[model samples]
Target chain A: MNESEKTRRKTRWFMLGAFVVAGAAFALIAATSMSKNLVYYWTPVDLYRAGNKAYGATIRLGGMVTPGSIKKLGGTAVEFDVHDATQHVHVKTSSVPPQMFRANIGVVVEGTMLRDGYFQSSRLMVSHNNEYKAPAKGHPVDQKTLRKMMESTEGIKD
Target chain B: MKTAWIFVVLGVAFLVAGSYLGLFVAPAEEYMGNVQRIMYVHVPTAWNWMLAVLYAFGAAIAFLFTANAKWDARLEAGLEVSTLLAFLLCCQGSIWAKPTWGVWWDWDPRLTSVAVLLFASIGIIALRGFVDDPHRRAVWSAVATIIASVDLPIVYYSVKWWNSLHQQQSSPQTVSSQFHLPLRLNAFGVLFLMIGFIMLRTRVANMNRARETALPPMTEHAGEIA
Candidate 1:
């Protein structure tokens, strides 16, 4: 081949090699990062199963709030138990919980599990259900009485 | 041309109506309350941006195989739309995150992958501008597009594949049925607008290429229209 043709061939191969190397490097980076950084939402049972592995790691715990397990600790801080039927994890949080937080509701807490068995939560999120019911007439939607009535009837045939 | 204009009008109307439904008609989310309304715009933009990238990816492959100028034109249009939508998605997500996540942004896997997607796509589109030769531009861009699209799946699966502050992907199975209507409406609205824009922009790209390559005459069909 002529000098120009040989140079062109070299350039083409170089470009191809560069792209292949880059693709491999990216795939490696993605795999490692995903494995290390992807935090799965664990239930109380999952947390218990994790045992020592669960301690001090920032993890998300999701479950329904155990009924009658809520307590106000004088300020924005609160304590509750999140249960997934099989296990329950006690959670304490200084942060104000979401407005929909309540007993028998699904929630996800983000924080660390302490040696004393309490989950110290930095954030609390209530997992809202999919049901949507219109408010009743003449009664304000925000009225405590109306909300209680709606909650009582929710999931039950009227 | 008329059909494209009709699409624009319909898209705007549906988007407005969907916004109204989301903001006023839909009940405040039990948990996030009123702030969840942002999902109307944010989710739709997220969905459409991926679709735009897929379009560009398909166009890139077709251009490489067929050496068709039309596919090149479509690839350009798709990239332009995807770039715009990706930027919009970031903005909307930031707004929603502030109240919900307590932070505007994080280096979480999902967010990082999406940022990579936006930058890589933008880079490919920008590279096209610097190349002057139409044939060279087409071939180089097609190669770049295929490489860039490797990020698309990473962006989509980031939440599932890694621990992310961003929530998992939502669908009919995951999202509340109540939110479905407005979400679908706005999704279609954005889709129609995206398609309309792509159609018009593709024509412009073709005309520009025709002007550049055609015999330097007023005899060229595109030149007469121009």
Candidate 2:
């Protein structure tokens, strides 16, 4: 083969080698980081299953607020029980809850589960299911009520 | 070129209108309150940057197939804009995240994927400068961009695929209509601005190519090589 052809063949091989090395490095980085950080919202049941592992580790607990579980504290602090049918957890937070925060709605709280058996939440988020509705034509509707109406009104006109 | 100015004017106008609606007209969000207004810009930037990256990815493929200089130019324009918007997205996300999440940043899946995407695009840009020969540079950069574009889907699906600090994707059904107007306005505003920038920037890339073509190839270092 001529000198130019030989040089071009070597360049192609080098390019392929570089591409493989880069791809491997990227995959390694992504896999390690993902394994370390992927924290799915855990149900109370998951927490129960987790046992000692759940304690002191930062977590996202998700479930419905039990009826009448809310206890108001001085200056925007509140404590409540979050439950999912079979399992339950006590949640405590100093930050004011969202306007739509109340009993029976699904809420996700992010914090650490203390060894004392309380979830000390630093952040709270309301989880709404996928549904849309035009504004209530007549009376103002509460968001929760709107969600209920949405569930029933599925397949019905807007 | 004259029409590009029109795009700029329209883009700026929509951006101003969107900001006005977000700041004064729209009611404060129930949960996040005033801080949610940042979404007007943040979401739009995120959308536009993805759009820009997709265009770059497409152009990169086209350049590979056709060996067209224009496609390479378009690819460069898209990469530059994508990088800028990715930076903006991170900044806006950080600001919004702080008050809401109680932290400035998290190594959550969604955030991490976006960081990776930004680094990939930046790497492609740097790759273009590292290679000397124009033909080789274009070919290798195009190949690199195509590979980097794989991260785009990973970024988009990161929240859904794994648990994340960021919320799931918001759609018309998911987002309340009350919050829709400014979001739509800002989305279009960024779209127009991105198009305008890419059009103007493509011309700049073309001029650069012309200058490069005029220069004697490798002449500056020929004596040293001898």
Candidate 3:
């Protein structure tokens, strides 16, 4: 091979070497982050074992908002208990609970760790189940539900 | 040499000062409270990644037009540094997302585009390195950067165009009139930090290239692998 061919070969190999290096870096990073999500998103078991350091630190709490535990105090203020199988947590907030946050369903709360050791949520999401529905065909729209949803949209900019 | 040192010192000092300003001085946001402090890391990281991509684009264009090896070297440096910075950005953003969005990752516009940008840029740089002809490498990577950069605005507005959990980025003066000056200073500090990183990274690329050019032909030492 000529001198140019040889150099080109080296450049190609060098680039290959770089990809090998970067791919490994990306894999390592991905694994670490996934592990952290599992480890740091404290479960009821983990939190109880360590006296709930998980509370009061910003976290995403996921559990079932217990059935009878939900109470409407006044206006938008609703209080409920979020429960895993083992331990349960008290949640206080004043906003519309997501449509999916039905009795004994999964919910995730995001926010800071309060001094009182509660997951003082700044954001809440009711888990959307990975369920599939058949495509709507001839079913007529429910007029009453449509009217109710329209009425609710008057004040919400979002 | 003196200019390099000046940047290094400034980078360190501004990093320290900016940390203090964002962490200590800025009042806790009324809603998110101290969890909002994560913004200091997230915003800067995202900003730095953007700047790094810009640097790569500028270097690529320069190399294409000037046909100078130095511009090629600069383009290589920008890509390397930007890739690492993009890695950091993904990490820090994951941390921030958990506190705000209740998930480590989301498949939304800002995020989806950034991922595409990172992967596409990596591909461009890889293609550049694979081609032995210096001119070809420069031209191809330059074209790649321009194409990749076109997606940046699309990524920036992704959240707005879609009904996404990611909130609208707060304008500087929107929070308080007092935030304007401090935020600008903070942005300036981020710019300086990026400049320093890019310069350092580019020097490394130059050294690697020099090493490649200076080495004797393969036949001269036929058995040895560099």
Candidate 4:
């Protein structure tokens, strides 16, 4: 075929291919995104609205760990409940908790919500907000007090 | 092409046997409980995706430098297989995430980057469809592959480099630990399946290309003497 003819042929094939791919992609996206029951994340509202139905189902519940609610049950076992302000889901785990799992820090608990409205957690994770650490606004290290305390304790031997 | 089935068989065998061993033989994770068993399959899917994407990147580079038609087919095969594996990886992650995070999906960096990469791969194949000339299509796709390479590192470090909840590599990922055997087997299983996917996809693309080229000439020759 001549040069222009070749270019025309190329264009046709390109269009043909594009059409096929586009159709396939549109279908896939539609299927995946439109999964109304995807069971991905449960907001406090979702948990409340879907309460009990969410029972026995494994899920990731996002919320702030309730302050003053963290109570150690034993050596390693601790009980804490998460709330997105609308609903509270208690979580129980027997492992050392993440530093971010304290009051007010956002946490995602992975586990099943029991029929008793508590989340029986197996994993505890903290979202380290270290990316946006601002300079310390409060008092710098209390170095003077530390020096006095250290001097007084100097008489002790390990 | 038929021989590619061997890898599929081998992959299924390894995945099943390794899963059984990892789930039943290994001691329960002290911290994560039975749900931790999901890690075996989840990790392997990520491994498969990485390897497949790496292969695509290399194939694209080869196409750019070698003027070889074969590399184009290979690149397409790599992308197709990797895209599927990536999809599976995300799904397995969701399954694991549900039990571990109490949610199936979240807005974490790792999750976001993977979603982007998957969409971009879909775009790449779509763009490939729009290119008519084989040579131009190859060159264009090579460009796409190179562009998509950025997503790899982003996904790899999404958790560490950002304020994401996803943990760093699982504790005891070290090969010297009890995970050594199961991990090796899982890795090998994923590898075999990946290669099998590439082989099968490449064969299909090759057959399709051949059919296109084999079409008879449009015009018949006229004899002057007649």
DockQ for all models, in order? 0.12, 0.16, 0.04, 0.05
TM-scores across all candidates?
Answer: 0.69, 0.74, 0.57, 0.60
Model 2: per-residue lDDT, tens digit, A34-141? 674545577787788898999988888877677799999889888998876578899998867766576665666889899888999977765433333334456655
lDDT ranking, best first: 2, 1, 4, 3
i-RMSD of model 4 (Å, 1 decimal) = 14.3
TM-score-wise, the better of 1 and 3 is 1
Task: Spell out the clash pairs found in candidate 2.
Answer: none
Q: 2 or 3: which has the higher lDDT?
A: 2
RMSD to the hidden true structure, all candidates: 8.6, 5.9, 14.5, 13.8
lDDT of 3 by residue, B99-205 (tens): 54456776544677688888887898789768764556766676666656655665576544432334445555234443333445556666676777677777777
What is the lDDT of every predicted structure here? 0.75, 0.76, 0.60, 0.67
Could you give candidate 4's per-residue lDDT for residues B72-171 as a string of tens digits? 8899999999889889988988876665455567766679889988988889999999876566778788767766766786678655444355655544
User: How does chain B score by TM in each prediction?
Assistant: 0.92, 0.95, 0.84, 0.88
Give Cα distance to truth, residue B85, candidate 2, Å. Answer: 1.1
**What is the Cα-based lDDT of residue B55 in candidate 2?**
97
Sort all candidates by DockQ, best to worst: 2, 1, 4, 3
Report the lDDT of model 3 for residue B174: 35
